[model samples]
Target: MKLTTTSRIAGSAALCASLALAGCGGGSGSGSQAQGQIVDGGTFTMALNADPGNLDPQSSAASALFTISQLAYDTLLGVDPAGGQIRSQLADRWSAAGTTVKLTLRKGVTCADGTPLTARTVADNLTYVGDPKNKSPFLGTFLPAGARAAADDATGEVTLTLAAPAPFVLNGLASLPIVCAGGMSDRTSLAKTTAGTGPYKLTEAVPGDHYTYAIRDGYTWGPNGASTATPGMPDTVTIRIVENPATAANLLLSGELNAAQVTGPDAQRLDKAGLFAARTAAVLGEQWYNQAEGRATRDPAVRLALTQALDLGQLRTVLGAGQATPPTTLAAIEPLACPGGTLASALPAHDPAAATEALKKIAGKTLTFAYSTAGGSAATATAELAVQQWKAAGITVTPKPQSGEAINQTLFGTGDWDIAWAQVNVNSPDQIVPFLSGPGVPDGTNFAGIRNSEYDAAVKRASAMDGTAGCATWLEAEAALVKAADVVPFANQQIATYGAKARFETPGQLIPTSIRMLDR
Candidate 1:
């Protein structure tokens, strides 16, 4: 099947120059806040290109904004930075035996709205996410079926019961910022407020623009590993929307901004400037294709050809220095990374000749490509390189630059594209569920619309088992996915974490809300 080429054809104008010219400055400034807030000294300004999909933790997938919300909102538990274990938050301590988990809530904690933070609030929040009616994309992956919460308000105790053993429970719970019962009663309303027992409170959010937060002085319940939740760091934390990396770099250099996401050559330039430090984390870069599009992408041959054609090193070069690491497996190339299997074998070598022959088999088919978020020159350049290789195999690819909303709609939304470029957040290997399972349309993250009973069975078997056995099951499942040509995973990219002059420890996972700034 032929891939649609958009990157090369769409560059009629210098894409970077046009984006910069369109008022895409580094970051914008909002008004200062009133005195005596959680951040009481200076305002911590963070510039992001896009606003989060929603404040409703359950409804939205992982994004730059979702990471930040954790600081403003608190979850029952959070991942510990020092040892990578689950740590207490509103719930002081927690233990699990089999599928049953008990939590001891911290007393004297209250929500921003004045309601006491109790076991009932924790119960309600857990139940709300598990309820299918809510249609939360994260529930099934993070929470097990038959999960229920029982709370004793008087004792400030809550117990969680799951259908089966879940090792990644804490990682999932960390994303669930506790909400009030009143807010939980109306899911739609709760999506916009900060009722959790977190350190910061969401003061305002202007969708598609920026969000504002102030420290909750009454908040003493925090992540167990946090040194201290001092209420005097920055009185206000404002997240400004700056879509252009060049503009963001400039602003950062000028000291108009505190932190910004620099990409492509811009990121390299920043490292050389000696003004800021940098950190990097591994993440997945998914080569998404639409299964419902009725194109060759649904055919195994086409998917295999594309996966084989991908030279990860080439892609990394396009990403520039220290932006990404080459990945051999679809999972994060870390401790839990699964081994080789059918999927790995089915992927063709990075030989253009073989790709051309495979394309010739499906000649006359055109593939449509969609990309989420604004691609810096590097991503665009990588796409261009991919197009050149695919064209050699006789494929005609049409690449389209669409908003993250539009891209999500096409894949998980309406299933309209033949192929697309997308990024998935992963802290552990289990996060690769949507793409490996069958019958179900992989909760919102599954862009390929993969469905295979074998693949599903393998993933389940692996999940119940431990260590290499489980990894083997997932390996087989990944092979099945590759063999079926469901989704093509090229590179599991790394996220660039730029350290600003403001002193603070960066979390292992790039969750913005969990970070606490320390004065130098």
Candidate 2:
């Protein structure tokens, strides 16, 4: 659940080209007429591709959960999507000295339950998420391990002490949604309720169907000083689960759906129809090998061989419809905290001969390959192609198709698969440190069971420096991982959302603060 980029507007050409669309223009509807004008009240209907399994931000790593959680909860900091700079949210001001960070809470902030938000409450949220006993997925990933927080109620200041120096501490804190004390106490209630200081309150939640939110009146505190009273702010928002992309697009064209993320061929049709679309770059093609004992991929030679067998150029073409950006690192989502050209030198060259030579040492070994169908046809096709390539290289591959949930269960639960098509998108290199260097499976998000001391050492070196200053060292560290074939990040694709009568900021997920109702 590494937090990626904040929502920023993308170029029209990039948006249209990524979706394989013809061109960009407003559709023949009220949306065209409603461009600049803001309406007072309207019910904004959005189509979600799938239902978020849990609403508790601490429990799930799903992007959908993070997007919706923004409506109810606010973090101490916010990110400027254009530059990845930290902005004030719940915390009006913050200062970091050594391994300690001090945050000053904003005035007049209150939770949805009418409880005044205090430094103590903020401290409680941090301590709870940082504690390993709570089994928060964000622990070690978003919140640094062994972080202790203390609050001064009278001064509205919270002090966070970290066990180790975290380079991107502020960026990590920006992604940690602050849950109210009541919600934190009763974690189960958070699965279907809202209890934070955001602009919306959950009114109704029907699992696998829809979740509705009503705007909170007099709500003023928001990221970057945004407010609920802003013009075009929706009085109500209905997020309807409509999995079919074509259906969602048709609904958008018919003016039934105000906003929806439509992928595949349907996106082209929507673009041709001239609907307003927002796009963001995200890593889509990533391969991880299970390095745990007893797995066929445990052998470094086998892992390297498998990676080298694939025709990555052809695979990228097939997976991205020839529009994929060659991956630079796992942190491909923009606004990248550390940008470099590591991929040009780090990624393994596609050489079937080299793969064949390496495979001879373990010629008869069979491996189980798992992939999720969550990406629809493109995912299935890519898996099949990989299987063919692996077979040609003298390795027997047992293709196992799993639903997204089942894939997560198998990779992190049963540990049954040897190879996986898993995508890990993060905004900063430090966010992926635990996944690459720490414990694996039930203990951590490093599901691949990778343990490279050299890579870990490089990461430690990079962590000591400031975020931007460590780019060269971070890129070198990533190269170590790729050179060892610990993971293969191949393709990054653009994801777009079509709007019929609304416009919202989309970096990786829709920014709740940016949603605006059009006067259609």
Best TM-score among the predictions, by candidate number: 2
Clashes of each: 17, 1
Global lDDT of each model?
A: 0.55, 0.72
lDDT of 1 by residue, 1-520 (tens): 0010110000100111110000000111111111112333567776665445567655644344344455556677765543456777777778877677888887787777788877887888788777766665555545654689889988888989888776556555654556766667676775666656666678888877778888666556665534224534566777776666677778877766666655568776766765443233333244655655456877666777776666756765675444554444554322333434334354445766677777786788777777643446666777777777777668888777665444545655666678776654344445456434532343444446666677778777876774345766667776666556565554433334443434333342234333434342
lDDT by residue (tens digit), candidate 2, 332-436: 666777876557467788889999899988778788998755455555677899999999988888889764445656766799989877665666777777667
Kindly report which residue stretches of model 2 are placed more than 4 angstroms away from their true locations once superposed.
1-36, 360-366
The TM-score obtained by model 2 is 0.90
Name the lDDT of candidate 1.
0.55
Q: Give the TM-score of candidate 1.
A: 0.83
> For all the candidates, what are their Cα RMSDs to the real structure?
7.5, 5.1
Error of 2 at 485 (Å): 1.5
